[model samples]
Target chain A: MNGISAEQLNQAHQADLAIQSEEGVVFEHAWADPDEGVIYCLSDAPSAEAVMRIHQRAGHPADEIHAVPLEV
Target chain B: MNGISAEQLNQAHQADLAIQSEEGVVFEHAWADPDEGVIYCLSDAPSAEAVMRIHQRAGHPADEIHAVPLEV
Candidate 1:
């Protein structure tokens, strides 16, 4: 999603929440760079695919995902 | 940054912290998707430019930044 507005992101986020349970996904937070048209979402899921599926059903299919097994 | 490793992100985070105070920036958390060549960092700063300055000084210049005035 390039140059997406906060309103649009909020709508997509709501959709994700509506169906995330089916995929055992819990979206925790999301960050959007409307000027850059970049979005970063954090979620708790069994796998990246699960996260992808939720977004897809939510009408904002993720371009890609990465596993973050470690953090500071 | 593309295909950036977790280690790399951590190092960058450290660098950000080292000089963030100079720019009134505090980086809280960071997520890296090595497979997708993406990284997401959360920070509290005076402005998007302040955030960019910190990252730039840390050697990982942000491609763009967006204000998240609202969240769920």
Candidate 2:
């Protein structure tokens, strides 16, 4: 799939918001293989905007920021 | 940070074996926000042990599996 389904995207967005609210800045992130069509991320900042800035500075902006719940 | 400092978890396990050798069965994944730690993922299942058996049947079993690189 070239793009994720709307429902999936919504879930991802919600997760992102949750993370942003908690973390503040996100500095790392990634997306799935096109064939598989998914997304993920990690960050070191305190805000989502900061994370986005990092991506922009790195010359690779993110398409989405997914909230990853850790087992640890 | 609760964890995630050993060279950023070895570049997130080398991007999770390069997305499990190009998407082999990763249902979905995420990690981070632990005081700005880092990790992320997304999948639809093709390999990686069927995305680790869908996280051991969705019971939450994933210490790490991050290789998210997407800009589209």
Candidate 3:
């Protein structure tokens, strides 16, 4: 995972807050490392690309998107 | 991030459920990508090392720990 940048954080933060308007997805949570330019997000979506699409649409393409099966 | 394995997952799962016995830390959530061998964890602790220490003691040391100033 690449470090998150402030630009990415701003975009992700906005995306998380605004994602309810999107389809086939709901942004659950986001983690940012401003110094490392890495952004991690948790979301309910059909596929990894769906999550990336949301971020791309929000003007922040993720460095990588891995499926995380939540176990909590 | 390195991928998570079944063995690591079991350790982390048990650790999550058993962390209440530890000090200065609270396991909030865990996400595992079993196929990719990556495990992401969210926890409340005084520092990143606190989270790692708990995991290390639990027998599944995390590959990375990033501070996420959660907004929701």
User: Tens-digit lDDT track for model 3 on A1-72?
Assistant: 355555656665676558744658777767666555456777888888777777787777777788876454
| Candidate 2 residue-wise lDDT, A1-72, digit = tens | 346555554455445545453436543443444446545445556555666755555444677654444532
TM-score of each: 0.77, 0.33, 0.75
- DockQ for every model, please: 0.41, 0.18, 0.43
- Where model 3 places Cα greater than 4 Å from the true spot, the runs are A1-11, A16-23, B1-11, B16-21
Docking class of 3: acceptable
Judged by lDDT against the true structure, how good is candidate 3? 0.69
* Fnat for candidate 2 (0 to 1): 0.33
lDDT of 1 by residue, A1-72 (tens): 667777888888899999999999999988776665668788999999999988887788888677765565
Top candidate (DockQ) = 3
lDDT of 2 by residue, B1-72 (tens): 356554554455445545453435643443454455544445655455666655545444566543333432
- lDDT for each residue of candidate 1 in B14-70, tens digit (9 for 90 to 100): 999999999898899887766656677788889999999888877888875777654
